[model samples]
Target chain A: MTDYTPYVAAVYGLALLVYGGYTLRWHASYKKLERQLASQSQESP
Target chain B: MNILKKIQPLVGLASLIVLAVGLWYVYQAPADFQQGGAVRILYIHVPSAKMALASYIFLTVASVLYLWKRHEGADILAEAAASVGAAFTVVTLASGSIWGKPMWGTWWAWDARLTSMLVLLILYKGLMVLRHSLDDPVKGARATAILAIVGAVDLPIIHYSVVWWRTLHQPPSLAAGANADIHISGPLLPPLLILSAAFILMGLYMVTVKARQIEASRHLDALEAARLHHDD
Candidate 1:
């Protein structure tokens, strides 16, 4: 049997790394925006 | 609950299912193929290409909606789709090249599929640059929408590139009702299909989230501008 371990690992690894990074970035930005909005609202009141 | 608000979660759930299915398929692929171990790349390359195509199609639709409805949501969707599509397109090209080097004996070729894909990357990048150059959001949206509509002409060309020109790249192997020479049997097909579905769902979900972010950012900017005017 041809060993497909390396190819499989590469594919999954890259997908997880890239997509995971994106998810993290999205969460961070969302939190930052929420904080900013909260601060602005507080200032207004 | 608003229908539009639910789109993101629905897409997220669908994408998760797809990712699970893809994992199952990749583990079960047959070992008898000529490409042997490296055939696993198919799962990624095919799905990424499909996503790239789908992104451009989505952009085209959003462009039309922007022109007709003048809706900010549509413009934001187009921008988000274009950005994600460009990333997927790059992955497709890179993975395809890696697979081709071992199988086709070259890292690059003048094949129609390859050339057309490169053109798509360029067009997407150009549109993104155009969007960022303008200070006015409305003006940027209008200009980018027009560019997107014009650039959509390349979509059909990319789709038909293999048919129109004699190239090194093989014709599509997954056409409906034809499985004569294609080796998409057993666990491979399921995972590949599942991954494609997952990518599409994930792409849509990301686009929706990005669109909302853009809208919120614009609102914040407008509020800031108004406050500055009041202070003046």
Candidate 2:
């Protein structure tokens, strides 16, 4: 029987890492765009 | 009333919850099964493969919409789905290989299922390349739409490859008969379902966000063009 614990941990850890990295990147990009829009709106006024 | 705006945050929260539950299940998995703890890799690998298949389906539908309706949103959705689908395909292959190393005593196989998945990955990459090669947005959309539709022909073959060929990979038990090969107990089933749901939701959220970014970039370009025209 294969000892599955370490492999399982690695798989789940990788998934979490990918998803977390994506979330952080998405949040940062959205925030940067929001800031740009805000500044644009202020300039227009 | 604004459904699209509400989807992202909701999906993000749901994905996090599902991830948590999936981790909990992994922690609880038995240590002495025939496959050992490596069986836990199934949670991520299987779900990602499913997502990859579903993503192609999404691309096909969106491609049809773009061709028939000439809708920019549909075209953008197809493009976004291609990117996510490609990423999921990579994840599926990576997790599968990792699991295979210990179980099958090999890291790679040229079986039909694996080969078809590799083809899908290549097709998706081609679509992305086509999307970037054209300068005109409309032309790029049309070209990629055609590619997406053509690529979807591989999905069914990929799904049935194990059944049709002599292969190292096992046929999908989930589709053959719910309880045929491996029984998913009460504890594991809920989290598996939740994680699958979460991944789909998150995928949709990412696509929408990407589409919005594309739209914003287009708007900025248009504004720049208008300013130059006015100055002229």
Residue B212 miss distance in model 1 (angstroms): 2.6
Q: Candidate 1, chain A: TM-score?
A: 0.79
DockQ of each: 0.45, 0.51
The segments of candidate 1 whose C-alpha lies over 4 angstroms from its true place after superposition are A1-8, B1-4, B158-183
- Candidate 1: C-alpha RMSD to true structure equals 4.1
- TM-score against truth, every candidate: 0.85, 0.82
Instruction: Supply the DockQ value of model 2.
Output: 0.51
Evaluated with TM-score, which candidate comes out highest?
A: 1
Candidate 1 residue pairs in clash (backbone atoms < 3 Å): none
lDDT of 1 by residue, B13-69 (tens): 888887887778777867545567676777887888788888999999999999999
Judge the docking of candidate 2 as incorrect, acceptable, medium or high.
medium
Q: When only chain A is evaluated, what TM-score does every model earn?
A: 0.79, 0.78
In order, the Cα lDDT scores of the candidates are 0.73, 0.71
